[model samples]
Target: MTAAAALIEAARALDALGFMPSKSGNLSVRTGRGYLITPAALPYAETTAADLVEVDLGGAVLAGHRRPSSEWRMHAAIYAARPEAGAVVHTHSPCATALACARQGLPPFHYMIAVGGGGDIRCSGYATFGTEALAEACVAALEGRRAALLANHGAVAIGRTLAGARTLAMEVENLARQYLALRAAGLAPVLLDEAELAAVFEQFDGYGRLG
Candidate 1:
């Protein structure tokens, strides 16, 4: 499917996952010439391909009738910093964002957490929305991971495809939920050792996985 089609599918999928409530999320996919993104303030369930806004790498709107998402600056910054990032997904999923708001990183308590590209998912310090500070914080937080949580805000996931980004978003939230549950049970989560994390990183490289 085309990148535009993939972007629409991602929005619907996030809506189904209850992650895009009240237009609380944004989705974008890189195109041959630029990127296509969901417009600002549109409910994901009701969004259409026509509702997408096309923008250049520098965040200049080139097509569509509506404004791009307020978080477009963050997305553009990510694209500029990470050329391997073909799609970006930002969402306000409850568990993940809750941990973020607590200024906590996703601890490496589960092997699945390695799916985030190595160790724990990083959390960026809080910043006002649509600001350059927010973009810079996100870029720094995502330096070595496929996903990063914005403190007191939401989460962002980057991938080689829109599907991959969506998958990482879901996984981050799932791991956060597990962490919460385990903590409530008075169990100290067992974190992966440095050797184990190194092995996972090496495997990822050997397999040519781009997440």
Candidate 2:
């Protein structure tokens, strides 16, 4: 399917999964000289391909009638920083958001944490949403990683495609849920060592069908 179609599908899927509740999250895809992103404040159930907005990496609107997602700056910054990134998915997934609210970054407690492109998932320092400050913070947090929690905000996942980004978003939430459960049980999860994570990252690089 086309990137636009995939973007819409991702929005619907994440919404159905209760990740973008109340329209609090956003999705975007890199396009010609710019990117197409979901409209601000639009419910995914009611959104269509035509409703997506296009903006240059500099945050200027390039096409479409609707305004881009409030977090467009964050998406734009990511694309500018990571050439391999083709899509970005930001969601207020419950468990992930809860972890972010506590300003907690995910440690490499599970080997699967390597899926996020690093030994751990980082959390950005607190910054108000929709501002360039938040974008800057997110970019720093996402350095050498594909996913991060927005402090007191939500989570951001980047990938080579919308599907990949969506998958990482869900993975982040899943890890968060598991981590939270451990913490609730008064367990400080034992993290995997760096050598193991290095091995996992090498495995991941060659393990995927699409890779």
Best by lDDT: 2
For candidate 2, write residues 1-211 as lDDT tens digits. 8777888899999999999989989999999788999999999999988998999999899988998999999999999999999999999999999999999899999978888888899999999999999999999999999999999999999999787888889999999999999999998899888888888877877987123
lDDT tens string, model 1, 1-211? 8777778888888878878778888989887767888999888767788889999878788989999999888988889899999999999888888889899988788877787876889999889988889999999999988899999988999998888898889988999899989988999998999998888778777776544
- Pairs of colliding residues, candidate 1: none
User: Where does candidate 1 stray beyond 4 Å?
Assistant: 203-211
Worst 10 residues of 2 by lDDT: 202-211
- Error (Å) of candidate 1 at residue 159 is 0.5
